[model samples]
Target: MRVAYYCQHVLGMGHFFRSLEIAKALADHEVDLISGGPEVRAELPPHVSLFRLPGLMMNDDFSELYPLEPGRSLEEVKNERARLLSERFLLFSPDLFLVELFPFGRNQFSFELLPLLQDIRDGHFGPVKVVCSLRDILVEKSNQEKYEARVVKRLNEFFNLLAVHADPALLRLDETFGSLDRVRIPVRYTGFVTTKPRSGAGIALRRELGLEPSQKLIVASIGGGKVGGRLLFAALQAFARLGLSGARMHVFSGPYMEASEFLALEKLASAIPGVILEHFTDRFLDYLDAADLSLSQAGYNTAMNILATGVPALVWPFDQNHEQRLRAEKLKQLGVLGILEDADLESERLAVRMAQAMEAGRRSGPAPVDLDGAANTARLLQDLAS
Candidate 1:
């Protein structure tokens, strides 16, 4: 079974990371991972080949963007590199082609995927099951319900299936899809996808994070390498706001961050006692396991890991983006978390909310969110392969 996964991120590693995780589960099958976003550090298992595209990613405030090279002309780039990469990517001839998020977001790069999806749909390519992978929420700017309806409906028609990685009961903030519950295509609530508890490495990670016998640590991480800079800043602010002098703040600024940016954050961490701001680490889930509370932006990856850890968190979904705000509200309503919006972000408020979130997090435990997602997703692809 050969599966071709297409994920492009301009700023962060959420989509690519999720696809890589899913790809690992299908290690027995041949895999081709393709990207157009700026380069990121991705470790793929055997049988997984990677394809890089034309542009190099630049980290702007919102997310990653691929600007044309310093000397290369845009026209030349389009005439040469883009054309070649697109042709090369098609050579894979995958049995199952998965489109991550573009059906709903990222219309600009539609050219990279449109030809492929069209070919598969038209039988130009061999029989392929095309699926659209959706994170729990489609972050939007405002209540652009009218514009969103068009996109969601088009996405529904464009693919054979919709795989939502979030448990809606935990956060049914999918205004776009929630209304289409009666649609014919299967809306598989595949649950949250997360890195499993690796036996050998997890213990060391916990120890390194300074989890005492029962310190009740709270780990706050933004998603991979982009878009969560403000969230990390907010976390630092939250620590100071909440006056968490005793609690350990393990802030993971993804490794892809600029040296100057990271050093600046490091300075902030130094001034604040009990704050350990560092670069990316492998023990994401383990830190969650050892944590008493978690703080982060509402990216699907971080949310899934938090759920997997079965600990509590104070999640402040991104404010500028409407998608995360809705997601944060949904998860909060499900009793899986507590939230502070970007509008409500401040040091004092964050400190108070962090305390409340910690208290709220401990009340009962992780409410039922999807945990069997990775296996279920793997099964879906395996069946498609067959």
Candidate 2:
């Protein structure tokens, strides 16, 4: 089977990573992973090929779109991107079209997406099984009724199925999108998509770091780093205040964090002993497995990583929407993790929380929700193609 997976990440890298995991799982199929956001570095499996469109990204607040390259007008980039995307679809002639967060999110790219979808429906790209890949929770729109209606119309008109990458036991699509009954298509819950750490990777990493059994390893990160400066700064300050002897804290500020903010974090981290700072790491899951405590935001990918590793985590949910907070609260109820409040950002308070979380240790037994979303997504797509 041939699959063309379309993913557009405007602000954060969570969407792209999740989509990539699913594509990796589809090793039996020929996959063209189409990405049109800021370039992200990743290692692809032999069966997967990446097709890049002209870069377009959103501002922090998602108020407007801009081209990644300088001196290129937004209109020019959009036109070129649309043309390239259409040409790619016609050339690839994929049996299935896996679109990430279209009607449920990333509506800004409708200038290209709507036209492409319409073309597919008109037989321009041959017989294509159009599917939507969505996350668990959705950000509340200002006009939710209109938003949902538009989504239902589009899904019914163009999409063949809606594959939500979330464990229904943890969260269902209808919980966030209220009008699920109106949509006339199959909607399957494929669990939560995430990459699993290698067997014994944590134990090996801990030994490589030359850490004593008594010493604690704390891992801190902000997904994509575009808006997590405060979380990283707070974590560093709290780690300094904790002053635990021999304990090490490794902080990844994410690749997209502003240079000034990263430089500030670098200076602050330099003043503290046993603290290491890096921009990003491919071994994040392995580090989480080795850590006694994890500190970060409650984004989709990070939450899934924590679940996969069972690391004791303290997460600061993104305040702009209820998506992160909703997921965080659910995990909190399951005793899998703890949530961070505004007041917790204070150095003393956060230090206390960190100590408590580390003392509590890793989660016991298996995770409460399903963690096989990537595999299940591949199976579903293959079955559909068959």
Candidate 3:
């Protein structure tokens, strides 16, 4: 089967990574992964091919859309992207058309997506089954009834399946988006999508970093570094205040952090003994596996990694949306980690929480929740195709 996967990551790289994992799982089939974010280095599996569109990104607040290339009009880029996307559909004629965060979110790209959907609905691309690939939690909007009606109309008209990447026992779609009963489509939970930790990867990494037996290691990251300036800054102050004996810290400020904010962290890290500053890494899960404690924002990918590695962590949900906060609160109830409220994001509060989390001890292994989403998704697609 041939799968055409469309993913547009406006503010962070989480969506791209999640989409890539699912594509990788379908290694036995032909896959064309279409991305509309600024180019970033990534690794895709053998059966997967990339189709990059003109890059468009959102501002920090997600209010404005702009091209990654300056001097290009947003209208022109949208038109070109729509044309390219339609061409891919005609050429590939995929068995499955999978879209990430559509109708429900990424509504900003409706200019292109709506046209593509119309083309598909008109039978221009014959008999392609459409699916919506959604994360566990959704951001609730005001006047949700009207918004949900639009989504239900679209999904019922164009989409065949809603593959929600989560465990319903832990969190169901209705918990966040209340109008699921009104939607007339088959919805299934594929469980949380994340990479499994390789055996001994953490031990090997610890040896490579020359971490001593007696030293305590803390791994900190800001997913994509788009809005973690406050968390990273507060972390530095908290690290200074703790000054735990034989404690070492490694911070990945994320690749998209502003240059000035990262430089400030670089200088600060230089002054602090046993502290290291770096950018993003593909081995993020390994770092989590090696850590005695983890600190970061609550994102779908990061949260899944922490769960897979059973790494005790301190997570601050990004406040612009309720998704992360709801996720954090649920996981906190499970006693898997600690939460630092946005209202209490001071150095002192962070330091206190970090210390408490570290004392809670590392999780022995992956959480009991479902973690076979990638493989399960591949099977589901194949079954649907058959």
Alpha-carbon TM-score of each model against the true structure: 0.82, 0.99, 0.97
Per-residue error for 53 in candidate 2, Å, reads 0.5
- Candidate 3 stretches with Cα past 4 Å from truth are none
Per-prediction tally of clashes: 10, 0, 0
Question: After aligning candidate 1 to the native by TM-score, how far in Å is the CA of 291 from where it should be?
Answer: 1.8
Query: With candidate 3 superimposed using the best TM-score fit, by how many Å does residue 76's alpha carbon deviate from the native?
Result: 0.9
Candidate ranking (TM-score, best to worst): 2, 3, 1
Q: Candidate 2 lDDT, tens digit per residue, 27-87? A: 9999999999988878999999999999999999888999999999999999999999999
Higher-TM-score candidate among 1 and 2? Answer: 2
Local accuracy of candidate 1 as per-residue lDDT tens digits, 1-386: 77777877766778788878877877778988877766767677888888877764544644434454778765565455456654764688787777787667776665546665666677876688877777777655345666566566666656777777766566553564445654456777777777765554444765775556445466777776455677677778777666544677888988677788888888888997788777876667777766777878877777777666666787767655566777667667767777766665676777777777676655344436666667778887677557
> How does candidate 3 score on lDDT?
0.88
Q: Is candidate 2 or candidate 3 better by TM-score?
A: 2
In candidate 2 the C-alpha lDDT for residue 149 amounts to 97
Q: Which stretches of candidate 1 lie over 4 Å from their true place?
A: 56-65, 78-82, 141-158, 171-174, 178-187, 199-204, 209-211, 214-216, 225-231, 237-247, 256-260, 342-345, 355-367
Query: Which model scores highest in lDDT?
Result: 2
Q: Which candidate is the best by TM-score?
A: 2
Q: Which runs in model 2 stand beyond 4 Å of their true positions?
A: none
Ranked by lDDT, the better of candidates 1 and 3 is: 3
